[model samples]
Target: MLSQFKTPLLLLSSLALCACSAVTQLSSTQSDATITIKEGKHSGNPRSETLKTTSFGNYEFKVEQPQGKVLYGVLPLKFNGGYLAADILFFAPAAFFNLREVYPYYEFDTEKGVVRYKNKPQDSWLEYAPLAAESERAKAYFNAKP
Candidate 1:
């Protein structure tokens, strides 16, 4: 009976370990798409660039910095919350975004240069960037037009 009990215990422990590993992989696997701008042509370096990646891909604008040399910027589209949260954070720069009324995007500090946008971050996996946000642009454009 004791040997039988030991075998069962070992099997149970193995299952528990597998479950824990699966959960760890699930959380760790979650990653967002990065949007970066290529200046001249270097390749790789420190300071990772970023950009919000939502279900609805709507990033397609060149942000013109008000001051400074005008380096690129990116927003970490993937975070605790995507799209909605990312948008609220990404396009926080309503100044330049104001002009791109159709998209209504943002720009936050990141490791690499800046990432520009012209639409709100969406939460749809199918939707992609290079797309236009003409509808949203008409609405929010005037609210904070640049």
Candidate 2:
């Protein structure tokens, strides 16, 4: 009797454990600005992305303004205790997966070419120095055109 339900229960538990994901919400002051994930399985606007927690690593992304200014950033994978506990109690394979500790919301500053997160003022995830000169050049070029 118990044996008949054991396999089904195991399969169900395994499926549930492997479905771990993290949600990242993105926004910008300029509605025309575009957000793109350069690395990992994500692409298109960063407005909202469901990242697979099982794949652990950095998710590099960029924000591009209409004038061609691009701001690069990285979203790293983080550990989730709840997922770990569930993995330990149910599926052992899921223990190896990692979760992304993303800010609930991200706002892109088009003018300053910066990406800011909610509640975190001092810390910025964007790589500002490398692209600063390029952005300036782009702005200058666009301004000169008209």
Per-model RMSD to reference: 16.9, 8.2
lDDT of each: 0.29, 0.59
* TM-score for each predicted model, relative to the true structure: 0.19, 0.58
**Per-residue accuracy of model 1 over 11-93 as CA lDDT, tens digit each:** 75664343221100000011222222322111122122333223433322232223432222222232223223433654433
Q: What is the lDDT of candidate 2?
A: 0.59
* Number of the top-ranking candidate, with TM-score as the measure: 2
Model 2, 106-137: lDDT tens digits are: 67665775666653445645423325554454
